[model samples]
Target: MNKNRVRLRCTYHGCELKQTGGIPYLAPYFDPLLQLLNIEVLDSSNHWKLFSKHALVHYGKQFARLGKLKRNDVIELTAQLRKDGSFVYPAHVRLLTNGPRREKIPESRTELIGYVMTQNGLYHLGGKYEYPHYVNQYENWLNKKDSTADQSKAESSSITPNQSYCHHHYGTHGNEKKGEK
Candidate 1:
């Protein structure tokens, strides 16, 4: 019942979540909530330029989906807590341009440029090619994903490149030797 956190109980299957001191269950919805709060605060300050920067960086896909850019833009994001405790964040992001940089950006290139959101607000994060800190968090996330994939691949395969291939290589399969077949 904290004033800052949005709490909703799941009605699906009568699932009751324990008070674990942290809402890890709601981690997926944190970005949406942050977006909502950011928009509200930005609108209050009437800073569409800053908002454009924010969208370009954090919402690359949503911004690319915009198709075109204008001098001013608005992106609608829904942060709904369902009765069953499920969270959905449907977004409608429209890119607005300023300073004569309006143009269609390739989806691959969109993520290359942008800003970083902090407690103070959005600031220029630069492109990935320039500063590592600009996309440090993102790069770390990608690395984490790759490592997990490698771990899974390693678990599924017993053979390693450093290991010498024996005569039973082609015949052996599923942890058994081909001669056994």
Candidate 2:
């Protein structure tokens, strides 16, 4: 709803931390004290239990985004954030190692299984070997489908009743009904 509102975004999943909003940005003051509680990682379920249930209800599948962050990184980031009076934990702030960066497997040996990734670069006889963002493609396809449906609905409504019946008889696939006159 509020696109301009800055959120505590995850550097990994690129989603925001929902459980931390609504209250004052008090995590900075208290997150340091949490180390005393023996809560090592903010991602731990036990660590999350410290917050009230109502605060965490709308989190959906979002975790604390702490997996890629160290305890020191959290403390430092929180401390720096409080100074600026901003809760927006942006994606670019890299204080912790995201993990060992592995070199991409050479494209020469890799093959795609219809937008499905296969381990060891498994190759099928007729499969396209290109790596693609299938999820984005799927979302685009859904948008296209919805747009076309709306256009077709509008067109059908504007057409004569007889024309609408004929259009349905010979569908998009050019397959006519078995008993069509």
Top TM-score hit: 1
With a 3 Å backbone cut-off (N, CA, C), the pairs that clash in candidate 1 are 10-84, 10-85, 11-84, 70-97, 171-178
In candidate 2, list every pair of residues with a backbone clash.
Answer: none
Candidate 1 lDDT (Cα, 0 to 1): 0.34
lDDT of all predictions: 0.34, 0.29
- Give candidate 2 misplaced runs (Cα > 4 Å): 1-132, 162-181
lDDT of 1 by residue, 1-181 (tens): 2222232211011101122243443321112111222232123244432222122123345554554333234434433433443334434443333254443332432122222222113333462233234245545544665888799887657665443356236544455544675
Q: Write the per-residue lDDT of candidate 2 for residues 41-81, one digit (tens) a residue.
A: 13324232222111111111112223222323321122112
